[model samples]
Every structure is written in C-alpha cells, then in structure tokens.
Target: MHMIQVVFMTVMVFFVIVTIHEWGHFYFAKRAGILVREFAIGFGPKLFSIKRGETRYTLRLVPAGGFVRMAGEDPELVEVQTGQTVAVRVKDGVVTRIYLDRLDERSNVVRGEVETIDIERKLKLALNADGVIESFDIHPQALMISKGKETQIAPLDRQFGSKTVGQRALAIVAGPVMNFILAFALFAAYFQMAGVPMENPDKLLIGDIVAGMPASKADIKVGDVIDSINGIKIGADSEKMIGIISKSVNVPLTFTVIRDGKPLTSKITPKKDPDTGVGKLGISAAIPSRPVSFGETFTYAGKAMKNMTILIFGGFKKILIGDFKMDDLGGPLRTAQVTSQIAEQGFTQLTSWVAVLSLYLGIFNLLPVPALDGSRLLFLGLEAVRGRPVDPNRESMVHFIGFAMLMLLMLAVTYNDILRLVRGEH
Candidate 1:
C-alpha cells in the first residue's frame, strides 16, 4: 500500500510535467509549420493512442517521461527531393525495380544500391535496347529506390534541417518556455489560495518547525499561539519576540502556549548554529493571511518563481563546483518518496513541490547538453553562424552518444537511491 501511494504520486507529478513539456514542443512545432508525428506521454509500450490532424497522441506504460516525435527530426530519408533522377523497371505496367543515380563532378555515374518494387510509371529514356546510357526526369510521386529499399525522399522544406535557424530555435526553446509558464501559473494559483507572505510576521503562531530542532524537541506544534516567552509577553510584533528569543540563546526559555485556548508552558534552549554563529530555535512564526489583489497575487507569484529559479541555478552551480555532496543527488525513486511526503502535507505543499520540480526540469533541459533543448539550440546557433545546418548524420551521432551517457548516469543515480532507501535514508 505504501509503495502504491508513492508510485501514484510519482506518476501524477511526472504526467503533468512531461505532458506539458512535450506539449510546448508540439505547439511551437505546429506553429512553425513543422510536422509533428507523435506527442506521447510516458515511454515504453503504448497503452492507447489517438491521431488528431498530423500528430498522433499516445499514452504509454512507463510514466517516467514523455517525448514529441517530429518528422525529419531523426536522420532518415523521409521523402524524395526534386531534381533527382529516378530509374524504374516496369513489368505489366507495374514497376519491378527502382534505382537512384547521382552524377559525379566528372559526370560519371554513381549508382546507389538497386531495389525491386511494384509501381506504374513511364520513363522517357535516352537509351537503345541495350539499356546502357540513359537519363530520366525527376518527378514527384515517382517511384524511387534507396539502398535496396523503396522510400520517399523528403521534400526540402518539410525537413527540420531545412528550416531557418530562427524557426528551429523557436521550436527548441518553446519546451522550456512553457515549463516556466507552468511554474508561474502553479505558483500564482497557490499564492492566490494560500495568500502570499506579509511584509511582517503578524502572529506569534508557529508556521514551520525544523525536525530535531529546539521547537520540535519541545513538542511545539505549528498552530500553537505563543502567549509568552521567558516570562516576556508575546505580542503581534514578531520581530521583537524573535529578538528576545535570540538573546536567550544559551539559556532555557519558558514558552507559554495556548493550544485550543488551554495555556501550557514548555522550557527549551536555543542553540547557537555552527553555520551562522547565531542563536536559533529552528522555528518560523506564521505570517497572517489576507486576501490579495489580482496584481499583488501575480507579483507574488512572479517573485516566487524567480526565487525558485535562482535557487535551482545556485544549486546547479554548487554541484559544478563540488560544493554539493554526492548523497544530495536523487533519482526517480527518491523523487517519488518526496512526492508522497509532500502530498500528505496537503495541497499547498504538493503544488509548491510541483512548481519547483517543473522549474528545475525546465532549467535542466535548457542546459547545453546533447539530446536536450539547449544542445539543439547550440546546433541552431552554429547553423546561424555558418549559414548552413550541421551534417545530419554527425549531429545524430553526437546526440546518440549523449543520450547513452545520460542513461548510464540515470542508472548510477538510481542505484544510489536504492542504497539510500535500504539504509532507511531518504
């Protein structure tokens, strides 16, 4: 049952995040007149799918991630291009063999592998019965053979590589842009429902308590309104009360609380924190909630989003600088565990977690790593500077290598997560 809950939470979070991310790419690709072949949520075998217009939307079994399949995105021949000679061998008005030929600089014939096919087409060849020297017209819908297989050569404009750098960049960047927008919207709704923090802490009620800290050790609950501290009266001026508590760092302070209107007292000592060299109780007073104006709600949401973005960026920098511990990194299992905990905390906490995760995912994909949006943007940048796209085969190989490395990294992280779980460490 516990495992089911964790799995459910993980699926819910991933479905929203991955679907939105893929939708971002799909929307922009459509907007740019690019062909999107598939927009799928999840991975592995398909559970169900539906086609709308040019795109097929699918729901797959694996809930870990999703993807958008764009036509000509991979290095493959999708259609036949114009001005290319195609040879067709016909029998009973049906093509039995097709061959594609290109001319070298010296006008020598460079024939590709032959392919047998069945089609009906008439070619006006400049050849005798010996069937030696001949030329043919390059026609659309004409039978074409490539590497002993019948395939359509993609039209130039239909290919992603044929798009202008700006268009390509727009499509690549859209996924992350939509993710940020999702974070903003989630934060906005959360702020509106829960109310943003006040400029001043308005009450002496405890809003947050750090576990294994002084307050938690004293059995202080979040909603317990503080009546007094160390025989000093607690007032609405939270700063003054905090100052008094801070001053009594090493000394035991008597906290008078009103739980359900019944007064109780508890003595606890605030220790000096090693990191900050400051007296701390590891508790934050609640800020009184009030209805916020529309403008204020958006303002608060935007600020929250910006702060989370900065936090993620700072954490990433710390990782790069070796400031973060190896144990700090987590994989899917850990995420699911955290998700379950946050869900139990209530909707506000869960939504906040979602927003943060979405923001992180967005930023992560924007990194200039191969097989990510940032790498594609880098390629587009190169194309913009070079006045031509990178060779499709080479680009594909680079992404393939990067993708394999990512898989290995995922496996390593997952193994670490399992070890931590076995040791009962979250």
Candidate 2:
C-alpha cells in the first residue's frame, strides 16, 4: 500500500510539472504561428489521444516525461512518387485533401497518378489524369490522409525554422520560464500556510519531531519547552542542550520539559547517524513565528526561492570542482523515495518539496547541454551572429548523442537508488 501511494504521488507530481512546462512551449509556438504537431504527456505507446485543430493531445504509458512536438523541428518526408495513384478533393481548383488509401468513399474525389509534388515550398502538385498532366495548387490548410490517419501538411511559413530567431528562442526558453513561475507560486502557497520562521536561537522549544525517530518515540511534542537534560540547568539555552545530546549517543538521558504549565520528564536515547557520526534527536528547535498579512507572504516566498537558487547553484559548482560524489546524485527512483518521505510529514512539507522540484527542473533545463532548451537557445544565438542557421542534420545528430548519454546517466543513478533502498539507507 505504501509503495502504491508513492507511485501515485510521483505520477501526479510529474504530470502537473511536465504538463505546465510543455504548455509553455505550446503557447509560444501558437503565438508565433508555428504548427504544433502534438502536445503529449509521457512517452512510448499512447493510452489515449484526441486531435483538436492542428495539435493532437496524447497521454502515453510512461509518466516520467513529456514533450511538445512542433512541425519542421524534425525531418518529415511526404513520399509521393511519380506513377503512384492518389485521390484528392479539390476546392476552387486547389487541392484541399489528398488520400493515399484506396478505400476512399467520398464523392467528387479526383483519382490521378502523381507526376510531381512540392508540399513544403510551392505547395504545387502535378497529376497525370487519364492522358493529360494537370497541375493544381495545394491549400495552406490542406489535409493528408494515409491508412485512416489525417494530418495537416505543413508549409514553409508554419515551420519552426521559418520563424525569426527571436521568436524561436522565446518558444524554446518558454518551458523553463513556466517552470520557474510554477515554483514561485508553490513557494508562495507554502508560505501562506506555514508562515515565515522567526529566529529564536536562545529558546529551546520543540518545533517538530521526526516520525519514528528518538524524539517522537519519547513522546516529545511540538510547543514543549525543554527545561533541562540529565538534571543540567539548561533553561532556554538550545546550544548547550544540543552539545549535551550530541555527546550522549546511544545513552539514555532524562529530559524535563514544561508542558501545559507543568513539568514532565521522559527518557530518550539519541541515535547515531552513519554519515555524520554524530548523535541526532531528529527534533528541530522551534523558531517563533506569527501569521503575516496577505501581502507579506509573497515577500518571504521570493526570498526563500532566491536562497534555494543560490544553494542549488553552489551544489553545481561543487560538482564541477570534483568536490561532489556521483553517489550523491539522485534519479527518478530516489526522487520518489524522498517525496514519499516528505508526503508523510503533511501537505505543507509536500508543497515545499514540489516547489523545490520545480525549481530544479527549471534550472536543469536551462543548462547549456545538448538536447536541452539551453542548447537550442545557443544554436539560435549562433544563427543571429552568423547569417544562416547551423546545418539541421548535424544539430540533430548532436542532440541525439546527448540524449543517449543522458539516458545512460539516468540508468546509473536509478541503479544506485535501488541499491541504497535495498540496503536500508536513506
């Protein structure tokens, strides 16, 4: 049951984050008049799909990621050879529809053998009808039918490459921008619910107790003021209490707290952390906080997000300097495990986790690595500097290789996560 809950929450979180990211690209592409072929959630075989206008929205089997497919972003060949018979629906001497299947039942269909075709540029089609070679212009909104599937033929004006460099760059960067916006909104929501923490270094009040930890097992509750430990007069001195507890690993100590205007005593043994080799009570000191006005929440949330950004960038710097370990990297499995642990803490903590994940997604996508939005933006920058864009075939190959490497890295990280889980390590 626990595993099921973890999987469900992971999917829900990924769906919301990825859908919003893809919607960003979809919106800008439509604004730029670029033809978006599909806005799909997940990968692999489709579970459900519906076509609305030019874009087909699909839900697939995998819930890990999603994409927005823009026309002319990929190489698509409309293979219509000479001497191949096809049926067409004509309107005002222009071809409105072309059917490659032989089971066409529509009336007023013109059957002919293809003589010449140019769907991308001139949109002209020459057909050999009977003994006469007749040419007709294809409509800009023309549809092509093959094996019962219908798709609009994209012309040069509606292709991604045909747009201005500025428009293309905006369309590519919009996804990451949306992710940052989502993160900010989530952080604001969290602040509204939990309020901003106020510094109270001198006090020794319990703010929260970790579930199943020593403090929780000892029946320690939030709002309890620690009066002393092992009969020491440690009133209001949080640092002194911490020093005494850290040195008493695996040793039972008497803790006296002021609760409900009366003194209560409990015995707790601090657990030794394997990584830090230090005793931990798994309880946080209470920093007094008061509810803020409605407008103040946004101010605190912004500051919190800024701090998180700085911390994330610092971690990246450590990794670049070879000060970080590969084992510290977490993939999808590790993320799910951590998310499940946070979910047990209640909704406020879950929202905070979601916000952090959103920020990570936004910043990671902006890295100048091939197969990411940053790489596309880099290509656009180069195009602006030069007179023409880079060769499409070469760019595609680089992105493909980068994508393979990323997949390999994901697999390695997932293996580590599984190993850690099996060994009962966090």
Candidate 3:
C-alpha cells in the first residue's frame, strides 16, 4: 500500500506541477490579448485535445511537462518589405518624402505621417523656431508587442509576447506560485496522520554476528532475534540488550533464539567487518520509528523547504564553478524513486519533500535569465529607470537567446537525470 501511495503521489505531483505551469502562461496571455495557439498540460504525444477559439488545449500522454505556445518574433516567419514607409525632408516651404530603405517585420525603421503642406518648412519652424523636439525619434512599437505572421497570432496581439511587460512577467511567475500552493495544501493534509506505529520498540530488536570467522560459519543473520544473550534476558529494554552485546563482543556468547516459538541455542563470536571497520552482521535490523509532535512537523516542513532551496542553489553554484558534475541532478525516475522512499518513511516525510520541490520550482523560475520571470523583471526595472520601454525587436532577440539557453540547460539536466537513474545514484 505504501508503494502504491508513492507511485500515485509522484504521478499526481508531476501532473499538477505541469498543469499549473502552463496555466500561468495561458491565463496572462489570454487577458493581455496574446493569441495562444496551443496550451498543453503535458509533454509527448497528445492524449486528448479540444479546440477553443484559436487555442488548442491539449493534455499529453506524459504529464511531467507542458508548454504555452504564443506568438511574436518567432523564427518561423519570413516576409518582404513593400517600401511603404519613408523619410521626409524639408528645407524651406517645399516638402519631400523619399524612400530610404525597405524593412520587414524585424526591421528597425520607424513609420508615420506628418500633415504639413510645407513639410520641410514645418520641420525648420518646429525645430529652429520652437527649438523643442519632444517625442521625436520615438517608435510606437518600441514598447509594444512585436506582432506579425511569424508570431503565430491567429488574429492580432494574441501571442504570449504580445502582452505588456507586466502581463508577460506575471504569467511566467504564476507557474511556480501554483506549485507552492499545491505543496502547502498537501502538507496541511499530512499533519492529520500522527500516532504510534504498529510495531513496538522492544519486540523489533537487532542482533549482531562475526564476519566469516565463526558466527558467519554458522550462517547467522545480522538481525536475528536473540531470546537471550550471555544468560541475560534482552529485549526488555535497549540498555540490557546493549550491555549483553558489549560484554560478549569477542567471546563465544550463547544466544538463545525462539525461532517459530521453538527454543534453540547458538554460540557465536561477534566481530566487526574488516572492510568497513564497524561492528556489523551480514544484514541490518529495522529499528522502530519515533513519532514527532505537530510543532516538530511544521518546523520540519518549513526547514525542508529552506533546505531544498539551498540545496538547489548550492548545487547550481557547484555546477557553475565546475566543482560538481551534472550527474548530481535527477529526472522523473529518480524523483519517483525518492517519492516512493519518502512515502515508505511516512506521510509527513513525503509532504515535506513535496514542499521542498515547490520551493525549487518557484526559485528556479524566477531566475532573471531569458525566458524567465527574472529577465522580464530586469526589463521592467530598466523601463522604470528610463521612463520608457525598450525596443521590441531588441527585447525579443534577448528573450530568444535566453530561451535557447534554457532549452539546452534542460536537455543537459535530463541527460544527467537519465544517467543517475541508470547508474543507481543512491
């Protein structure tokens, strides 16, 4: 049952995280008039899809990943300039409009019209007479969304990038916030299941044996339940058991075992394993688990969240400094294995890990590198400083580069994860 719970939790968590991530993009893009071509809830082949307006909302077979496809400055579009916009020159009363150069979707040429019978004269009058050039050289689309055919806008500003900077940034950040929310809710349910475990501390006890010397020759299991050792009753308390085992370490100790309730006597010398230099038997014993208080559980949950974030950042720093190999990272298989182990330990442990994962999701997404909330935040700060927005083309280019970097990073991490799983990292 615990194993089943582990599998279920792992699958559910992946699905929830992916769904929430994509939803962030979908929500903000919709409100910002950004046309979404496809809003997917997972990766791989589509399991099911429904077309709504211009968007095809899809649920894929693999629930570990998802994406929101939006438009603007996509590399997939190609076009030719028609030479519609040109530069206007005015000296005295005569005005002259001349074609400077033809530019396309990505072209930096500014286009607009000025109504003046004597355009040249008007420029001198406006420039020399007024001596004030307010809003000159300003590009309307500089701060606006780069909307075009390649942008995948089914209608107009329906692509993800078409939204305002604030909208886009918020959309990107929503995914991680949802993950934290899910984590909090999962743990809130876990705090309810606390009690004494079924097995008592005394009945489940540990016994030791020597290596291949004498006890090993008798084929003694490390965790064999000894009815009595050194003619002293054990299992009544840990102190008595420890005393008996300590005194008979190197000597031939009589161990009475009640195997299947049958009285049996065995004599064996206990020795440490030469390889590990630690007293041990061929096997290990399952010790009783200690129950914790509600306060302890809450504290553990918060600490677990902090620890996970620290571990993630520390690992990232190590990798950045070339001190840690990418193999330290894990993908779905490792996550599933970990999830299962946590579930086996108890609900609190599992939920605590979930909270940790949530923290990871939030922190990683906020990094101010291209295709992340942080990068958008950087632009926002710049706009605030400059009192205006940046060129749309340049902003889009930076984001494109960032997206490429992120994809490469994800691919590398996934490869590392596969390797860790195949090699049994734990």
Candidate 4:
C-alpha cells in the first residue's frame, strides 16, 4: 500500500539521518578523548538502554528525539524520554532502579479516584479563580521522580581544551558529514542494485503542465497525452527524450497528442531554467521502465547524485534567505509522505532521495546554528582566529541563545506543518 510505503520511508529517513548525525559527534568525541556518556536515539524516557564503552547508548520511548550525552558536558542535542513510571534513585553518583508501588503519598479521594489535593490550588479554587490556571487537570499518575542524577554531569573537560582548534572543529563538523556520507552510500547502493533511471518513452506520462508556461502556452493541456515530438513518434523504441528536448532548445517543436477521440498538434519550445541548465517546458515527467546497465552505471549514478545535490543546495539556500517559507518546512508527517512516495516509485528513486537527503543532512549540519555541530565548529573557528579560547561563559551564552532560537524555529515550522495538515494541503 502507498500508505505503508510512506510510513516505512519516514522511519528509514529518521533512522538513517539520526544515526549519521549522532555518529558524527560520537566518533570525533571518542577521538578527541572526551568522556562521552550517552549516545541515545529518540527523545524522552528510555524504553531501553545498553551500557557500552563510557556511554549508555539508549533507545528512548519517544521516537521524536535522541542525543549523545558526554560526561561533565551538556549536549546541544537533548534526549527527551517518556515513561509510565520509572522508579530510580541516585546516590553518590549511582543510579539504582526501584519499584514505584512502594512509594507513599497523601491522598484525597475525588470522583472515585485518589489524588493529592494541591494546597495552593485548593486556595486558588476556593477563590473561584477562573482561567486555564483555575482548571487543575493534574496527572498525579505522572509524578516527577525526585531522584537526582547518580552520575555527575561534568563540565566538558580541559582535555577538550588540549585538542588543537582543527581537531575540535573536526569533532564538531563530523556529525553532519556522517549524515551526508550515510545518505550518499545508501543512495549509491540502491542505484547500483536497481540500475540507473533511463529517460524512457513508452512509459512516459505527464502529470502536470505549468500554467502560462511553455507547455500551456503551446496548448499542451493536462490529459492531452503526448505521443511524439517533432515527428519522432514516442513509443517502445523512443530513446533520449531529454536529448531531444536539449536539441530543440529555443526552437519550436511539434507535439503529437491524443485528446478525446482525435489527435492534436501542440508546439512548444524547450527553454532552459538557466540556473539548472535543464531543458524544460514546465512538464512533469514519469516513466515505468526498469533499466539496468552494468557498465557506466557508476557514471550515471554519480551524475544523478550531483544533480540531486545541486537541487538540494538551491532549496536550502532559498529557505535560508527567506525565499522559501517556513510552511514549506517538513517535519515527521511530510517525511512520511515522501518516504511512501519514494518507496512506491521503486528503490532507485528512494536511493536518489537518500543521496540528495544525505547531501542536505551534511550541508545543513555545517550551518552555524547552536546545538548544531556546525555552530560549535564556528565558535571554535572564532577562538582559533583570536588565538585564545573565547570566554567559555560567553560561548555558553551564545549557544544557549542559539539553542533557544533553534527550538523556537522548530516549533514554528512544526506548527506550520500541522496547520497545513489540518487544511488537507498535504
């Protein structure tokens, strides 16, 4: 089912992406002799964990977030965990698990349920305070576990200080690079296995024609169904549709199409988007062919990867410079949709997305955003430039501000995504 594909793609994207990003930090941190504590996937209460090396690599209950925790250091990435009830106690930097039924609390019965009456709330309720404040919908079941961390979250070590600026920057930049590497490999492997997508003819179908664009201007309407171009019939023997268009660039070409019970002629000139150097008439193209070429496959794959990277880069730039709106931002839902589409289109398409996505992952991480590997590296660069460590306090402050801003931006994009979903805008 298309829906199933979407769900699968979404999971694949997250796992692949998250692993690469975190691995960047993990690898470099280990190399830099930092005391890494936790390498976790997903955020929230840990559903499970494995203690390995000097770290607890965790798989948390919340699939939405994950992070690597370093001893004496706060991560730019935060792990948010969810749990029904986890009874754990910390003492002398040791964490020991305990059962929750053994704990006691003063209870007041209300509506056939036991609850602890909030003394402050009772006062406020007695005053007939009305507002969201007056509505005390406390979940006593979700009690805050008071046990302190048994392990001391140490400040990032002076050993981190001992590393050359380049090393520190590498440690910071590696996470994003890992994401990109993962993406490219994933993409290339798929391409190698499934074969490069050749521009096929018999399977070609147009889904959309841009309004007022060359295609529409030539009366090439949707459902017109193209059969040939420039008297070269399109069918089983048709090869190089792109080549044909490239040859016809800036020159009018006739399109033979079937409309209703009659054949029609529509003439359009292929024009270049200039920026991409691709032939276009604003027509959407798709095919049903599965072609495999053992020879030159890598060459074709490499070319596709390059194109994907270019497109992704341009898209990211648009977003950065405000040419793209926040509503265009994708969160989990959109990712799921894309994953499904990619999977349905076949592994080759999916792989292509992976490569493109990987490049995106790599480049985006390079951004100088706090809590991001790139931002950390940027600060390290500033330190190196000054020939001294920037004041740690100021560094911390800037990162903190960056982190807050990043969170806010994420919230905004997520909100936009939800709004679009509500409007059934996909």
Best by TM-score: 2
Residue 188 Cα positional deviation in candidate 3, in Å, after optimal superposition = 3.2
* Per-residue C-alpha lDDT of model 4 across residues 190-287, encoded as one tens digit per residue: 76676544464454555456654688677655545557888877654334556687666688888777667587887788887688776677776544
Whose TM-score is higher: candidate 3's or candidate 4's?
4
Which residue pairs does candidate 2 place in steric collision?
none
Order of quality (lDDT): 2, 1, 4, 3
Model 2 ranges off by over 4 Å: 1-7, 91-94, 103-108, 199-205, 221-236, 254-265, 272-279
Q: By lDDT, who's the top model here?
A: 2
Better of 2 and 3 by TM-score: 2
lDDT of 1 by residue, 1-426 (tens): 265665677678888988889888888777776767689987789999887765678999856667888767774443333433454554444333346643232122323222221221332233222445434433423335565544443345545666778887888888888889998888888887788665665456777787667888886787788778877787677777778777776888888878988988898888888886666888888766777889987898888988888889999899789997768888777887788877765677778889898888899999988988899889888988998888988888888898888777777788899999999886
* Off by more than 4 A, model 1: 1-9, 45-53, 60-64, 75-156, 209-221, 229-232, 236-284
- Poorest stretch of ten by lDDT in candidate 3: 117-126
lDDT (tens digit, per residue) of candidate 2 on 1-426: 266776677677888888889999999999999999999998779999999988999999866578899989886545778888988999999999998886357679888899998888999999898979989999988998887788789999999999999999999999999999999999999988887656554446787788768998886687788778899977566778889888989999898888888889999999998898778888877665567677887888788789999999998899889997777898888888888877766677888999998888889889888888888899899999997999999999988888789888888898999999999888
For candidate 4, the 10 contiguous residues with the lowest summed lDDT are: 123-132
lDDT of each: 0.73, 0.86, 0.57, 0.61
Q: How much lDDT does candidate 3 score?
A: 0.57
Clash pairs, candidate 1, are: 79-152, 79-153, 79-154, 80-152, 80-153, 80-154, 95-119
